[model samples]
Target chain A: MKRWLPSSLLSGMLFVLWLLLNQSLDPAHLLLGTVLAVVAPLLARTLMQPIGYPRLAKPIILIRLLGMALVEIVHSAITVSRLILFPKPDGMNSQFIKIPLDLRNPYGLALLSCLINSTPGTVWVEILPNRHELVLHVFDLHSEQWWVDTIKTRYEKPIIDIFHEEVHKENPP
Target chain B: MNEMETIPLWAAALLVSLLILGGSIILIGALGLMRLPDFYQRIHGPAITVTLGAGCVLIASMLYFTVLQSRLVLHELLITVFVLMTAPIVSMLIIRAAVYRDLRARKRDSGVESGGIYRFPEQE
Candidate 1:
């Protein structure tokens, strides 16, 4: 049973989603959804094969991250709106800044991209593998160093903690 | 004139305006899809519809239904949540596929990475 249903949380969420979508207490729908909830992942299990599960040791940190993200969203929204409504004299100073990263885990990199892209003023432009640099575009850049510091301190460290990887500490040029 | 009960004039006006605004924005987004010159620029156009247009319509739905039902009916929230979560994924997949196809075509056309460094090409 453990081998077959490796992710209890995922399976439970799938089952709940099935019920929410069906929206009926009818036995037929319940039985059908249950079958789907179990069988779908079972069928999917062969595709990539499961990797080792991370311990997920930091729930408090994750909550703090969520709070910080919500605050950032509001702040970034105001900044972007101002830029959109009133064109800056220099226009948008869009430049690709490459920040060297030590976090090599695939999942950590994915989370970093999601955080960067979800923020209004920034976009994750690219990641250069051979050089271990991730490129980002900022809508407003008073100082390149500030952006690099914010990314490393606010987003990257939390991800590193969650994913548990050694990342090299480097100052942006 | 008899004081017949009707939706408060202001409420009716607000609902109508919101519905129109939502519909028009969605239409404009669709139009942008055709009018924009390139794939990347065109992609940004639909974000307006998905974010603001859908938001307007959902708010209108919530407002209209709450008034009618005398209590909040929030089934519309599922639609909003699903759209919000899924739209980015859909957009990313489409962009990635388009980039991959362009790179493949470029390679066959010139057999060089001179165009740019593609992170995950079709071959990968």
Candidate 2:
């Protein structure tokens, strides 16, 4: 079963999307979607071999992250709105800061970038892989320490917990 | 307090809030793009519009349609989920490309920070 359907979830989603898109249960749509679902992943498999299954223990933590991010977006919008309306020629401290990262997991790193970039006033600029540092541009550079702390406490820790590194992750409760 | 009161006030209220929230979020995101100091900072700004802004509007649509039809009308949920997943990938790729360009430019401009991750060692 696993051999035939490399990604069962992908196949299922593809089938569903095909149905929804066509808004019909016609024989032709089913055949085409099924063929696409099977063939596309198979083609993709040649280019990219699938990785080992990921450790997704704490689902609640991910939900919490989403909630936190939404709130941050709202807060950031208001702050940016104020900054724009009242031009802060002197008050605003715009600069780039390099954040050192310990989590080496590619997926974790990707999540970290999304978290940082989605929030207003900050952008992921450069990632120095050799040094394990991410260069981020911030609209208001209140303190370098603040940015470092925020990234570590808010994003890195949760990602590490969620991704579950064999050697790095602590035993979850 | 109008004579035409077929639809519930709660539904009307939800739709109003949804549009308001969605529109404002988009506005702020665009404003962020203009207000931000540099190109890198501007990249993060539109994500607000992509995620939360679109999310609120979609939810509103889902709610309105479902209530009107008296059934669980979804499908917008798929778009919301799709956007949520895709936005990060797009942002990372763009940022990576931009950083590469910046690093290359720096190497051309100043003959320093060479052999770092930002730069490859020149062949002799």
Native interface contact recovery, all models: 0.00, 0.24
lDDT of candidate 2 over A52-126, digit per residue (tens): 323456768988987898888778766766675576776566666777888877667777777776676777765
Q: For candidate 2, lDDT tens digit of each residue in B1-124?
A: 3423555789989889999989987887788778766665567568678876887899999888777766677778778778877776677678677766766765553421332333222211
lDDT of each: 0.63, 0.71
Candidate 1 collision pairs: none
Which of the numbered candidates is closest to the native, going by highest DockQ? 2
Residues B1-124, model 1: lDDT tens digits: 2322444677667789989978876776666566644554355456556755686799889777766656656667778767766665666566556655765765653312232344332243
For model 1, the stretches where C-alpha displacement exceeds 4 angstroms are A50-55, A165-173, B1-124
Q: DockQ of all candidates, in order? A: 0.13, 0.26
Residue-level lDDT tens digits of model 1 in A20-139: 676656888888877877777777766635443233456577678867975785466445544444556744454446677877766577667655655555656556645677765455
* TM-score of model 1 (first chain only): 0.81
Error of 1 at A91 (Å): 1.5
In the order shown, the candidates' Cα RMSDs to the true structure are: 7.8, 6.3
lDDT of 2: 0.71
